[model samples]
Target: DEMAQIREFIEIAGEYGLAYEYINCALERHPYKISGKAAIKLLEVGLLMGFKSGRENDKRFDRR
Candidate 1:
């Protein structure tokens, strides 16, 4: 039932401006296998890194 429940979790995450990411782990196999939780963590890490980098560049912008 995990597949059925994933959508529910994804929607909940979206409400908080977050995303549920999915990655293909079995590309060599006939049918690709998806890594669900791992994808989520990867996305979260990427987003955090992007935000941190952006903050470091904040000095380049001038409101006035």
Candidate 2:
């Protein structure tokens, strides 16, 4: 499910995937030139998505 969500997200928002891959490469090679805000925003959105999904899963588990 997580993979599916990630795949859907990548398909729906290709820009974010591009940004992530670019940043991943850039950080490994040269870590100083990346825009901090853009990286932070990306991480924030990712964390939010994970949190929301975890909460939903928790609810489902609790309902059992």
Query: Which candidate's lDDT is highest?
Result: 2
lDDT of 1 by residue, 1-64 (tens): 4344455556655422222222221233346454888667765775664422223344454232
Candidates' TM-scores? 0.27, 0.32
lDDT of 1: 0.42
Best by TM-score: 2
Clashes of each: 0, 0
- Model 2: residue 45 alpha-carbon error in angstroms: 1.3
lDDT of the candidates, in the order given = 0.42, 0.53
C-alpha RMSD (angstroms) for model 1: 11.2
Tens-digit lDDT string for candidate 2 (1-64): 4446555656787655444444444565664565889778866875554422224434653322
